[model samples]
Target: MDERELRNCFGKFPTGVTIVSWFDGSVQKGITVNSFTSVSLDPPLALVSIHKEAKACTGMKDKAFTINILSDEQESIAWQFAGSKQEILEIDWDNKGISPKINGSVAWMECKPWREYDAGDHVLFVGEIQELHFEDLEALTFYQGKMGSAKQLVK
Candidate 1:
């Protein structure tokens, strides 16, 4: 199998969209990430995997980061961060937590750095969830190389 074939196969799995954000001393840095998940509720842990070359990865060295679960209406915000160059974050950022978080997201998890691992070209940044909040809004998701919205089907 080739790279595109692998990526296409990976795209088949639906993933929630999250903006992994952190502060690099003086400024905020972040990236659009679909690679985030809850690790363990016992310890209240979670993970957000970012590319090794992403600024947010290196900037997170000794700081805190936030996992902002994007809502369906925040598709434009996703595109803005995932764009080629780091577009200046023009959104209202809330500082009531460990790291800067976007306003109006479906949910937010403020985490302190827990651990990190090398996962191929990505750096898995695990965090201990220090604070969390959620709303009843729908979530943004990615699947089959497209962005979409998802609502809890069982609830």
Candidate 2:
């Protein structure tokens, strides 16, 4: 299949939105990513795939990063980090004394890089979860190039 077909097929699967934040001195850099997942429970490992062209990709090396899992109410926050805006001054953000985190997110996971692999169009960053937090809110989801909420799939 062509690249367009491949992307379309990939988009068929829905995924949660997350903001991966890292520190550049006092300044914080973050990017919205849907390509994130748990790798292992015993080691508490997770991974995020970032495009080679992303500016935030290079800044993450050897630095602590926080994955702020967006709630359904955080579509604007996701769009902000997704590069929809030239500036994200309106978003409520804090460093949480560890790493940058978006306020009011459903969950947050602070991690340190464990490994990085070159994956052609993207780099896969594996991280060891350092800290985590959760709130009682529904998560935001991305599917077919649009934002929405996850619907429970009861079997």
Which candidate should be chosen as best, given lDDT against the real structure?
Answer: 2
lDDT of 1 at 94: 88
Every model's TM-score: 0.89, 0.91
Scanning candidate 1 in windows of ten residues, the lowest lDDT window is 146-155
Give the winner by TM-score. 2
Q: Which residue pairs collide, candidate 2?
A: none
Cα-based lDDT for every prediction: 0.84, 0.87
TM-score of 1: 0.89
Clashing residue pairs in candidate 1 (N, C-alpha, C atoms within 3 angstroms): none
**Please, what are the lDDT tens digits per residue for candidate 2 over residues 1-155?**
59999999999888999999988999888999999999999899999999999888788877888988999988887888898874545767787766788889999889988899999989999989988989999999898888878774211
| Stretches of candidate 1 exceeding 4 Å from the true structure | 84-89, 151-155
